[model samples]
Target: MLPHDDNPLFATFARAQIRVERGEGVWLHTSDGRRFLDFTGGIAVNSLGHAHPHLVAAITAQASKLWHVSNLFEIPGQERLAERLTEASFADKAFFTNSGAEALECAIKTARRYHYVNGQPERYRILTFEGAFHGRTLATIAAGGQKKYLEGFGPKVEGFDQVAFGDHEALAAAVTDETAAILVEPIQGEGGIRAVPEVCLKGLRDLCDEKGILLIYDEVQTGIGRTGTFFAYEHSGAEPDILASAKGIGGGFPMGVCLATAEAAKGMTPGTHGTTFGGNPLAMAVGNAVLDVVLGEGFLAEVRRTALLFKQSLASLADRYPEMIEAVRGEGLLIGIKPRVPNGAFIEALRGHEMLAAPAGDNVIRFLPPLNVTPEEVREAMRRIEAAAAELSGRPAEGAAEGAAA
Candidate 1:
């Protein structure tokens, strides 16, 4: 048995343990029977909320029929999901994976291979921005270009260069003959819910076009209707040679996919790279179920409408308590509140009101409620947030007579 706060094989995450027993749309129930509004969305992994009937039905049905088979066998679910992804984006090919890190790793290899196939093996470097969070793999830590994550790891991986977030000239100057690709996240999630400027996205597309270097967008956090769009890149029409998608792709299930243009995919042949458990029937079936809801008629449109309502509500909240929340940023359900105080303090205050939010870098608290969260839920959440802000900052509870300033 595991002692309090001590696990033999599992590392402790933050400082809390809920032992969540069940979850439904936008609400999680702990083993003690307390309910909390889950704005964290499993840190943006639960795209369709928890325990959706369709996802449960599909996974249950598939699990009963067949759980998994080696990549050596044909899988119809993979076929349909791949076709759906390509149809929705500029990609001509796709490769499945079990997580976002693996998807990004494949993208890196594919980008390098593109250069090698073009007779430029020396083009191995990838230009990534600082304050970016890609993943935790050895190569990804290098690609993220963050020193904090790489502190304990010795002898950093080679061929990664860091540049300023929106500096076009600095980014352009960083690119050299050795540069094979430019990797960026459409929205930096973990590093903070920092949205890449549209001008910078388009400028990178233009620069990559002129230099013949591949452009890769890591949509692991912003994809699958998180930002009220099928893909965050669609917001700017800045298509990349390769795009990595995960997190929300499988609703709550684990799945990741790398979408690449035909030219880029050409570098990845049958024997060049593969994963045995990546495209198994179980994952594919869940992926299909997720896509069915995400790509369904009027589903995303409703999400966009909800996004507008959420913005109005959040703006009002910010206006009411100017000290606790500095500004509201980000798009869709993937909203971020730049806190005047520490984000950790804000999250702690939220716990008192039974609202759960995830903390990000740069003093930002990410609000990632389920994509299908209703207006009533949003209004209720706003009330709790107002109360928390008032309590945390010692401000008047919104229109209370005691503190008329609110």
Candidate 2:
């Protein structure tokens, strides 16, 4: 055995035991030539699916022209992307970063600084929701306040107050005079695909407005058309003063964006915040490509249509295997399967059937298929899921097939 055979990389991630060589569309290929239907979509990062021609062309074209430059200089691609982002959303200004963590960091800083410069320096605390995942950064982890991610990370960063998820009374009570903002995920991606109800989101907006506090949405996992809209906030009709977006924004390229209203961004002066490698030409090029596809006519409508079909199919599957599946949750293509079996075992069963899925909190298995996934692909995924469930039940494939035909 080689020295690297044991553990060459950090032991942080419990990666699936598959060695992926390349991917195209919704399929992953192993070095040994095995193909797996990938429903994870790289944890919702592959917005346009793997190796999308437009994204590839954009990245290659930019690679041939310009790549990285200091943020001190003006970047036309960044400016164009920022313009497109702001124009398509409720934001008036945009800031770029390399990942969702940095985006959230910018949002946290922007919220605090907004209060600071507005003569309310004491209102630095941010109220966050339980089961919400912002990122892994110290500030974001502290904002999330999940003990699993906060363990042994030293004293938790201050100014983050956590309230029970979706408890309007608790949220209202948690807010103090020191609260500068309320940060939340429109759809709790890692918190088992729990989407906050529209009423609750509107209530949060009302609370923030009443308290003179900012409202921030961490749309990292649910943004960029994953939820059949440009951002998940669109579903609730509640607009945030600041929004953090990443993941699918660059179509698998590393990128993050912090969008804010002009009033909310008053404190983000030249020296207040900056990034070195963010919004590079390469990342901006891919980001533009992703926008071209996502913002195209009929694209998001098709995503909604496809998501409805997928969700109905999943609902039928759950009905058929009630003993195996507890429920199907989530919106658009970001789905979660709450199974009666252990989520890890359920995911392994899907892997055994050569299908990829992601595991989430609360024993949920996430299905983050690409936004452009075809209707045929959704049907195929349902078949594979049924097969996996049958396998788990120790039943022959034909038995399940006959029952389905009935």
What is the lDDT of every predicted structure here?
0.89, 0.91
State the lDDT of candidate 2 residue by residue for 47-120, as single tens digits. 98899999999999999999988897899999999999999999999999999999999999999999999999
List runs of model 2 lying over 4 Å from the truth: 1-6, 396-406
Q: Score every model by TM-score.
A: 0.96, 0.97
lDDT of 1 at 117: 87
Q: Lowest lDDT 10-mer window, candidate 1?
A: 397-406
RMSD of each: 2.5, 2.2
Candidate 1's C-alpha runs over 4 A off are 1-6, 399-406
